[model samples]
Target: MIDIDIRPAVPADAGAVLDFWKTAAEGTSISDDVAGVTRLVQRDPGALLLAESDGVLVGTVIAGWDGWRASLYRLAVHPSRRRQGLSRALLDAAEERFVALGGRRGDAMVLEANEPAHHAWAAAGYRREDHWRRWTKPLA
Candidate 1:
């Protein structure tokens, strides 16, 4: 097992994180760009969590807490680094952050079609809320 270091993303890490997501993440979001990520880092520095090994990026997860709800997003692991506990490590860090911030529960956004991700989430003890549907309109 490699020594994985999990930490909050800094402003300088935005570009690399974007590139990592393009390869590691299953799908892209409107806020996956450099500008959007930079804005996120500027606003909430500890919201974006990253996992690295020997300075190379391996995984990422966003634990967003807005006083009431704790939302998790962008959980991704490098293709070459999957099934090695990277995702679990990232989630553990994210959950710890949320708990520290007085967050009661955590919600994750998992794609309906991503079966692998679904299994992973289940393994992490997160179950899908079949009663809820996501509705959104792009601002751009």
Candidate 2:
């Protein structure tokens, strides 16, 4: 097992987390704008967890709960750190935090075509309930 430390993400962690996000978002529908990420980190500092190895941020998962349901997003692990179970550890930590915050259920939206994500979610005990055909009307 890789030696990693999981901690609540602070504003200072934005840059490192963004680096992981850039790589993870490739070939996927998930997109996170810098300003948006900044706001999110600020809004709920503890909702963002950073996984560090040798004092370097290598993984991240953002979770939130609003008294009813909890949700997880932006779960990314550095390519070099993949397949080491760090992502699972991070997800588990996030779920624990949400549950402690009174979350009764958890949810996440993954691209329908992302098999890896589906598998990961399933492996982590998340089950799909409903499917929706999303539509986007871009205003250019």
Candidate 3:
């Protein structure tokens, strides 16, 4: 495991964040749009936690609090950095941020087919709360 550091993301980190997201393994929902990440960071820098290994952005997780509830989203650890404590550290920081903002409970949505993510979340003290079926409506 390389030396890892977790911290809130700033607008300057957007480029690195988008690069990592795009190069991540297939089947990840990480966005490749630098502009989108920049906007997100500008709006809520505290919600974006980034993990760095030797000055490289290896992981990212977004913790969004909407007054009443907090949701963890877009957690991605670099393929090379797997099995290290980076993900756990990112999650811990995210949860701490949530708690500081008066979040009483938290939630995460992991794809049912993504076993590794599901296991990681479970290991980090999350459990299946309910089954949700998705219905997508495309706008033209």
Candidate 3 clash pair list: none
Q: What is the lDDT of candidate 3?
A: 0.80
Where in model 1 is the C-alpha error above 4 Å? Answer: none
User: lDDT per residue, candidate 3, 1-140, as tens digits?
Assistant: 45888888888887777777777533544344677677777777698898887788889888988788788887889988888877788888899998899998878867778888988888899898676665667453
TM-score between candidate 3 and the true structure? 0.85
Clashes of each: 0, 0, 0
For 2-76, candidate 2 gives per-residue lDDT tens digits of 799999877766666777677764343333556656777788778888889889888888797656768787778
Taken over the whole model, the C-alpha lDDT of each candidate is 0.92, 0.77, 0.80
Residue 131, candidate 1: C-alpha displacement in angstroms = 0.4
- Kindly indicate the candidate among 2 and 3 with the higher lDDT: 3
Q: Would you list the clashing residue pairs of candidate 2?
A: none
Cα error of candidate 2 at position 45, Å: 1.8
lDDT of 1 by residue, 1-140 (tens): 65899989998999999999989998888887889998888888899999999999999999988899999999999999999999999998998999999998899999989999999999999999889999999777
Clashing pairs in 1: none
